[model samples]
Target: MNIRHYFDLCVEAGGQVFERIGLTDDYRASRGTGFFTAEHHIRYYAETRVGEEVSVYVRGVDRSDKVVHMVALLVNDTTRRLSCTLEIAAIHVDLRTRSAAPFAADVATAIDRELAADTADWPVPVCGAMGIRR
Candidate 1:
C-alpha cells in the first residue's frame, strides 16, 4: 500500500533465510528471542502497482557479535526489473532482557554459511549524510 509496506514485504522474505538457519517458529517461541531490525535503508528505483507480482531476494552481507547486515531486492516479476533495494542491520536480542545478545553458536555458524554462499550482486545505494543542497 505504501513504500514502507514494500520494504516490510522484502524483510519478510528475508526472514525465510533466518528460518532456514534454525530460527524456526518453535525455536523462537521456546527461546523467547529472535533477531530484530535495528536499522534499515531503502532506495526505490521504480514504482509498482497493486496486483503486480514482485519477488524479493535477500543475501547476507556481513555480521558481527551483535548484528547481521543484509541486502534485499524487490523485483517486478513481469518486467524483470528491480523495484527497490533494502539494506538491513538486524540485531539478536534477548526478548526478556530487551538487550543485545550474541547469536547462539549454531545460529552464528548458519549465518556465516549464508554469508559465504550469497553471491548476489546488485547496485548498492550511496549511504552518507542526507541534506538539501544548493
Candidate 2:
C-alpha cells in the first residue's frame, strides 16, 4: 500500500482500538482535540505486496505538557517483515485560543496502558513509494 493509505489505515485501526476501550467517543473525538494536527516521522525498513495482511501496533506513548507521543510499528504478517516505524507527536490545543495545554493525565494513562498491552501482528515495508522519512 502507499504511505498515505498506510497512514490512514493506522489512524483508523488506532481509532477503533481507542473507541473499543472507551478512550474515544468517535474518530474525531478520540484525538482529544477536534482533530489531530500530527507531526509524523516515519522510517521504512521494507515493503509489502498486495493481498498481504498487515498489522498496526502501538509500541509506546508519552505525554509532555503540550503533546502526546505515539510510536507505532507496522509489520507484514505474510513476510514477517517490519514495514515501517512511526513516531507521531500530537498536541492538544484549544481550538479557539490556538494554545497548547498539558495533556490530560487520564488520557495519558489510557494511552500508556493500551500501548503497553499492544501485541498485534503487522505487515512489511509499511511505507509507500515516496522517499519521505518523516
Where in model 2 is the C-alpha error above 4 Å?
Answer: 17-35, 115-134
What global local distance difference test value does model 2 have?
0.62
TM-score of each: 0.83, 0.67
Q: Write the per-residue lDDT of candidate 1 for residues 1-134, one digit (tens) a residue.
A: 48877878888888888888888879878987787888778888888888888899887767887788877889888777888878888888888888988888888899999887866475444343321122
Name the candidate that leads on TM-score: 1
Alpha-carbon shift of residue 114 in model 1 (angstroms)? 0.9
Give per-residue CA lDDT, model 2, range 1-134, as digits (tens). Answer: 78886676667765665565454545235454432545767787788777899998765454555665666677899999878777666666755566675556766676667756756564323334322123
lDDT winner: 1
